[model samples]
Target: MSAKRPVRRATPLRKPVAGTPAWVMPVAVVAGIAVLIAAFWVIHWYTTPLPPKPLSQDTTTVVVSMMTGLPASEFDAVGQGTANNLIKPVSGTKLLGSTGKPEVFYLGAEYCPFCAAERWPLIIALSRFGTFTGLQTTTSSSTDVYPNTMTFTFRKAQYTSQYIDFRAVETTDRDQNPLQTPSTSEQKLVSQYNIAGSIPFVDFANQYVFTGATYSPDTITGMSWQAVAGTLQQPDSTQAKAIIGSANLITAAVCKITGDQPATVCASATIQNLEKTLK
Candidate 1:
């Protein structure tokens, strides 16, 4: 009679502990380092500040200096034909402002790359005849061609001149959102003269129409606000050749509409030469 010996439960097998492969530890370390690097990159991308959304105080000062101080002699040297391809002559009823002065109407959107480029010469040219207050710095649309092109915006700006009246319509913002709507008269002008239905259109007293930028925006691409403004001082620089050259032509156009008033400006040998070539 034998009492069956208590069956002993088989000992549970323990997890086999083989020596760790030399490659496994290095692989684990490398994988861990890669994860840390990825995390750091994501953090840096989200935290890094983008280019200043608006002009800083220092940048504004530079802009003011450049716009107000570009030498007339330098602009003359840049010469004509830079804007000839951009501006066209149109003879119709005269366009006058509220003050009975000839009006220079500019219709454009901040998002427009051409508008961005045109504004440089436009501001420099207008500054010759008058002063601008409340000018703000901005960039063109990030999604548009020539994205992020730097320039000034006239949204909160005002211009005063004894020679002529300047009117700017920043129809849309840098994001292509409507910033300033065009007036009924402005709309009519757009429909009438802007046959191309494009932005950055300029109607100089209804005597001349500028359909697009006078020069390639590429000239100033990747330039900082300060750099672009500073280039106006250097006549030999390509930026000056494009920006100041266009300005000279615009000055000539405005002089024609103003009856060549402010003789100091229109009488300049360079402007006079450009005036003769104006179509």
Candidate 2:
């Protein structure tokens, strides 16, 4: 019986091939997955269209020309269409200015639908104080609430004025990629006043702040840039009421910062009345 038990033997354990490393299969599988992912992204890149280039000189002129606000009566007619009192007083902060002038800080993103809607009034208001060059056109993220909302991009834009100084930081583009970076102070002001850290945020000389769109993006949905600019000229239009009305209030805010410097704008009956409502 002892001899029979001795004849039994255990099965041999399987070993990797003599020349191959044990880890090679797993490494190859991981590498294959990585290559597939890279290839997918590469394909996507080639398939997607790029954002449009900076606006042409003629188009810019037309758009800027259209930004000139509507009549005081027209503004009253479309008052606050989908827009509430967006601007608020940012207390406990020093006057935000630079180079001996008041500063208007803008923080938003290209893919933001609310920012898209807000830019209309914002640009309308700013045009009264300064000029913009190198403005580009883009649409909000197609997957967002207001998909393909055609609007302007401030990324390559430059604002110039004698009454006030302007600063804009487009944190991300339509693809949600990192864009312009804001200075520490610019970011701090946003953090302090805009606790929610919402975009389309604007700071007017530390006197007032806006955390959201002045109007709803739905108003301008499905509209083209040229079509929207066309609406600004029509005082009776819904777009005019929302955009021009909001622009009037913004103008009033800017007026307070500039001491009503540019009488042509601040002294307007519209802005004067709106200025009184400021906090």
Per-model lDDT: 0.85, 0.80
TM-score of each: 0.80, 0.76
The digit string of per-residue lDDT tens for model 2 on 38-135 reads 99999877865444344576886677676654455565555444457777777755454566688888899988999988888888788888888877
Write the residue-wise lDDT of candidate 1 on 1-279 in tens digits: 978898889999999899988999999999999999999989877864354577776768667777678776787778763554567798789999878899999999988999999998899889989988888898887667777898889999999999889999998888778888889988998889987789789999999988888899988978888888787777788888888888888988999999998898889998898888776
Q: lDDT at 61 for candidate 1?
A: 63
- Candidate 1: the clashing residue pairs are none
Best by lDDT: 1
C-alpha lDDT (0 to 100) for residue 177 of candidate 2: 94
